[model samples]
Target: MVGVAVLAAALLLRYAALEAGVFPLDCAGAAADGIGGLCAAKWLLVQSFLHQRLGWLSFVLGLAAFATRRRGLAWAGWGSGIAGLVLYSFDPAAIGALLSLLVLARAASQRRRGEEQPGEEPRDGLGVGGLG
Candidate 1:
């Protein structure tokens, strides 16, 4: 799933950004600059990074829940996934995950009732539909 991949990518990027000098972790003597201003900056950066990571995680979990076609998971996933994406880009993976869950749910319910989708030709013995 595209959603899984995007979430995974976002996770990787989060860590990578943290370790890649996106923020300064060494603020030992920052107090000299003004009551630990450097320390405060570093703390903010780390906190933001963590929040971003949580968002990515939520997106991934939502996708997995969608794949399983669980109603509870579907609701949770959509709720958290969309919220998480609010601070990030509108990635196609999230959209895909949501749509897939909807489709899977529909298919599952139809299968349970032995029903077929509208406009779909019936299958033949050879595993083909409307083919001679």
Candidate 2:
């Protein structure tokens, strides 16, 4: 499913950029001032930045998928997106917001579809009184 794929891609990109860390400089002495050091730092910085952007993009796409009745994808989007956001740790409260949004959206979608669970009888507005 697209939700799973987006989550997988986001996870992979996140892991790849993990090595960048807060400070990418690991070399000692003046060697770090050379071209190789600059290149290494540049590559790591760029990768990290791009990873964040891509991760956010994946989350946005997952939300869109959910809007189209992809319940599984909606759940996956919230789970992975929250996990990644927490792991990166920008704001602790964002996870809660994302979770709440997911719940609301999923519930709304289900209501709109009017789907009945297995072994559950469909409801009718008319009661036994037959007042319609």
Candidate 3:
């Protein structure tokens, strides 16, 4: 949810800072001048999230969500992946998006460890994890 909100804000920032004739695809010059905060936001949205070569942020968030089984992290990974793809960071973003889906599915289907009754028999009754 927070990720989505951040993305929305980024979209507005993109229009206002970059698309609004404020920077004209040139960030460095604008930074040298006085007006930088919005331009910095522009640089961050473009260089950091959307146009980054590797989509590292999305990749890392996806990997973390995959490893930790946290739905919130999964949401973040998914959002970043979308940003990466829709705005130019394609391949790695695909990986990140896939990882996010897997994490969400795993979180939904898997039972919590704390809920298990230590030696309780598998409810499916195939003799442990339904593997039999």
Candidate 4:
């Protein structure tokens, strides 16, 4: 629920930025000019490229994590989200990351509750046979 909302928000922001042409500008005279328009424009270009590349990567990784129930991959998605946040703090990437983290946390909680799939042992080493 919350995760879905976050992802939806993130997607909206990402697409909006793409549609707004707010990325990739020259930095020269950006400081002297109001709003650092040139710098922002340059950074937007860089961010746009990164967004394109990392966005797809994160999506693929996140989808794989969800489909395969791999918590680590989900965490990787979270990391990617963080990177996206760093690039554009108010973007959909951040929402995507938050959603990924939420999903990972939910899966972890489910595992803690003994609801894990068959043959899928918990990684925390709580029930090992040789321990005291």
Estimate candidate 3's alpha-carbon lDDT, on a 0 to 1 scale: 0.70
Off by over 4 Å in 1: 1-51, 89-129
lDDT of 2 by residue, 1-132 (tens): 543665576565556554545335544435456646545654644554454642454356465654564655556555556545534533322443364356657677669977656785335322344347
lDDT of 1 by residue, 1-132 (tens): 645665565565456654566555566665456635546755654554354653555556556666675656665555445544543534533663465468556756777867765775546323775535
Candidate 1 residue 38 Cα shift, in angstroms, is 20
Alpha carbon lDDT of each predicted model: 0.55, 0.51, 0.70, 0.61
Error of 4 at 5 (Å): 25
lDDT of 1 at 124: 32
Clashing pairs in 2: none
Residue 67 lDDT in candidate 2: 54
Q: Each model's TM-score, in the order given?
A: 0.38, 0.35, 0.59, 0.44
Q: Which 10-residue window of candidate 2 scores lowest in summed lDDT?
A: 121-130
Q: Cα-based RMSD of the predictions, in order?
A: 10.1, 8.8, 4.8, 9.6
The candidates, ranked best first by lDDT, are 3, 4, 1, 2
lDDT of 3 by residue, 1-86 (tens): 65567567656655665567776465566445664665665665566654464366778888999999789988888888776765
The whole-model C-alpha lDDT of candidate 2 against the native structure comes to 0.51
Q: Where in model 3 is the C-alpha error above 4 Å?
A: 1-38, 49-54, 110-132
**Which one wins by TM-score: 2 or 3?**
3
Cα error, residue 80 of model 2, in Å, equals: 2.2
